[model samples]
Target: MVLPALMLFVAVVLIPLAMTVLLSFNDWGQYKGIEQVFILKNWREIWEDDYFLEMFLRTFRIAVLATLITALLGAPEAYILNRMQGRWKGFFLLVILGPLLISVVARTLGWALLFGGANGVVNKALMSLGVIGAPIPFMFTETGVVVALAHVMMPFMVLSVWAALQRVDPQIENAAMSLGAGHATILRRIVLPQIMPGILSGAIIVFSLSASAFATPSIIGGRRLKVAATLAYDEFLNTLNWPLGAAVAVLLLVALVLIVVGSNALIERRYAEVFR
Candidate 1:
């Protein structure tokens, strides 16, 4: 049973990862077709290149911000949903799952229109309210990208935390409340501890998804903002620089792995007593 799954994992994940690592070391252009010469040039260039480094950090920052925002908003929403009764619960759950029904490209395109300049609905509404003399720039900016990414990633965060919230015993919460614990106190002391796993998992998913997202950022961010994933896409498709693109892909994979492992380790260490 386990062996077949393990074999599938190796075939689907490990082989491609190995190829990407190998390709990163050798310089190759589209027409050149892998020169087969191994060198550290790609790695060296990536390290010394300020643009690549900045884009890498920018991707990390946006991902973190999106994940944090998702947690702050999603956790409460999940809690509320968990406490709801009857048909409303199913309706809210369906609403959260609604975004998944739409194509991401279509959703992002909708955001592009909403964030558009002067003629956009948002700007027009604000202008009509006399809030600003001119339209605020959102399209092709980091703020726009972040907003769109957050919207795209919110459902995952909510669903994950909701699953965790479901496992928490209402009896424990009631007991805490009967003991004179306030709402905040019961939540912080009783509810949060049990739901930490869900929060962590959701954050991990959001961070990874947002960091690698191409459509939302590309459409909302436009040509001005460059994220690691977009940069990789440009190098591979536009510039035809296979080696550089491979290096960026590998860097992204490494960064995501480190974050996930580090988060899991921290959660396990901090919750050792609870787990035992």
Candidate 2:
């Protein structure tokens, strides 16, 4: 049973990944196009270039911020949703997930319109509310990208924490309350610990997706602010530097794999007794 699945995985995922890795070792030029010869030129260029360094750092920074925002907001929202009863729960859940039903491109374009510089809807609304003295730049900025990406990725975080909440015993809270534990203490000690796995799982999902995200970042950050994904896209499509793009993509994949695996290991260790 597992053999067939493993074979399918190798065929669908591993083959393309291996090919991409091989392609990264090949050479490319403006006039020459892609040359079949294997070399470390692409990798070496990425390693030595400060531009690549800044771009990767910016990419991870945005991903981290987006993940943190989602965790902070989504965890609480999920808790609230879990506590609600009947149709109200379903209604709010639907509203929370409405964004997921739309095309990511469409959603991002909507954000682009809202984030239309100083005259944008967001800025105007804030100005009207006296939230700021002047318009803030949203279009073509990292803040815009982070905000959009967080919105896009929020559903995953909420759903993950909701699932974790399902495994939690409601009586535990009651038991703690019976022992003279206040609401805050019960929540801090009993609820959060139980839901931690979900939060970590959601963080992994959000962070990984955010890091590799292309569309939202491209639309929000524009040409001036380039993340790793957009930079790879430019190299492949605009510059016609497929080898270089492949290298960048492979590096991103490797980084994400390492980070996710490390995160999982830490989570497992920390939650060993609880999970067991």
Candidate 3:
């Protein structure tokens, strides 16, 4: 079973990634050859491009926001779930994780329905309440992208925190309480310290997912709020510049790797110190 899965990763992920990294440096076209030789030109072009810069910044910002939101909401829910018994906890876990099992298109479309154009459900409610004269622009905007990505990434955070919370010995919390630690003190000083590893792991996972998401931003934010993923999509699909798209794709991968490494290092250090 594991062998099959590992081979799939090499096929679907590893080989393609290696190719992308190579293509990012060299000029690879459909029919073109060495005339368009390898250099730093592709990287230079990306760095100088306004669209690339804007979209890169927006993607990073949106990813951070979504990751943080998921961590904040997921941690508490996971903690609460950890305290639940029997099938109720399992049932709630299913409820939280269910949306992730659905297609990105379906989830983003659901948001679009609630926030699409002037006649969206959310707009209608806002208008009826006289909160605004016009529909609040939700779809095709950064706000929309962040909201949808956060929702999509919530499961990653919840599952991580749940695992961490499970590993925590209840006796530690009981001992803290017996030592006259108040509820808030117990949570802040004891509970949070123990669960920090889980929270950090979940946050990093959420960050990477949001940063790499293509469909969520494209459908929910439309073509207006282009993220790094959408930018890569346009480069390859719309402009037919496979080399540029591959470059952008490589950059995305590098960004994810760096974030993952940095987050893990920081969290591991903190985890070590707290437990010590």
Return the top candidate by lDDT.
2
Better of 1 and 2 by lDDT: 2
Question: Per-residue lDDT for 66-159 in model 1, tens only?
Answer: 8988999999999999999999999998999999999999999998888778688888988999998998888987878888898899999999
Q: Candidate 2's C-alpha lDDT? A: 0.95
| Candidate order (TM-score) | 2, 1, 3
* lDDT score at residue 165, model 3, on the 0-100 scale: 89
lDDT by residue (tens digit), candidate 3, 1-276: 699999999999999888777777777555674234667777999888887888888989999999888988989999999999999988998999899789988988898888878898988998999999987788888887888888888888999999988889999989989999998998898889788888888888888888999889999887877888988999888877877888898988887899799878987787688679
On a 0 to 1 TM-score scale, where does candidate 1 land against the true structure?
0.91
lDDT scores of the candidates, listed in order: 0.90, 0.95, 0.86
**Candidate 2 per-residue C-alpha lDDT over 189-208 given as tens digits, one digit per residue, 9 for 90 to 100:** 99998898899999999999
lDDT for 57 (candidate 1): 90
Candidate 3: 10-residue stretch with minimal lDDT: 28-37
Better of 1 and 3 by lDDT: 1
Ranking by lDDT: 2, 1, 3
